[model samples]
Target: MTERVLVAYASKNGSTAGIATMIAEALREQGLAAEARAVGEVESVGPYDAVVLGGALYAGRWRREAVRFAWHHEADLTERPVWLFSSGPLDATAREGLIPPVPGVQRLVDRLKARGHVTFGGCLQDGAKGRIARMIVKSGRGGDFRDPEQIRLWARGVARELVKEVATP
Candidate 1:
């Protein structure tokens, strides 16, 4: 049977959503059934065989809706395969310096026994922010830092792992 995967995300300016969509596409390319949906729009994870949950970070915290979804779906998520990701660092090197996952997210990851947690570079748009915010980003961090190839590579790895899991036992 084909595994059904859910790629759900919470994004402020749509970057994380785009990443989630890319992941879902990559999984589909690998021949798995996958769907991408906003965290707020997902009412249940009951139907999915695996889940990829992600959110944008701000002030060192994931978006509230992502956190809430994890909390509300704790049991269902714990019974399925789960992977987590945070998309926020503006540069590749910046990803290496990210603080540990927030306690709530970490706790959920533990409960879900998630397969992995990845941090990916994020995009910053000059026009989306106020002048001061734009100035801060322009100081050195403004750009579309997301690498589609990297994202696709990670998604393919995930697809391989899921295939292996299904084959086992």
Candidate 2:
């Protein structure tokens, strides 16, 4: 059977969700069965052969929902192939180089034994939720920094790894 992959995310302002969707689409193009879903909406990870979990960043920290999901499904995630991603950094740095996971997320990566991790640029645009977000937008600091091509490329790399793993076994 084709690998069943789950591209799950914890997004606060919809940017991370968009990245997760791109990932799932790329995996499908690579002939794997993949779907993107919110971490809170998923009850179990047992159905997936592999997982790509992502979170948005705030104040140099991974979103709380993402952290909670990782720990909550620690047992199941460790038993399968897992990749982690973070979508933040409102700049081009993510596409330019590898941005290491934050301390909290690094702990999750270590505990889960995730196969790999990547950090992507984030988006903060008008009408974003939260007072802080509004302030950023008002201060002219909020803008969409997400690059779809970069996200797709990363997802394709992830697909290659997953395909290789499944083919080996």
Question: What C-alpha RMSD separates each model from the true structure?
Answer: 2.4, 0.9
Local lDDT at 91 for model 1? 68
lDDT of candidate 1 over 28-113, digit per residue (tens):
99999999999988988999999999998776778889888888998999898899988877767534454466666687678889
What are the per-residue Cα lDDT tens digits for candidate 2 across 27-132? 8998999999999999999999999999999999998999999989999999999999998888788978888899998888899999889999999998899998
Question: Per-candidate TM vs. native?
Answer: 0.89, 0.97
Best by lDDT: 2
Best by TM-score: 2
- Model 2, residue 110: what's the lDDT? 95
TM-score of candidate 2 against the unseen true structure: 0.97
Candidate 2, residue 120: lDDT:
90
Clashing pairs in 2: none
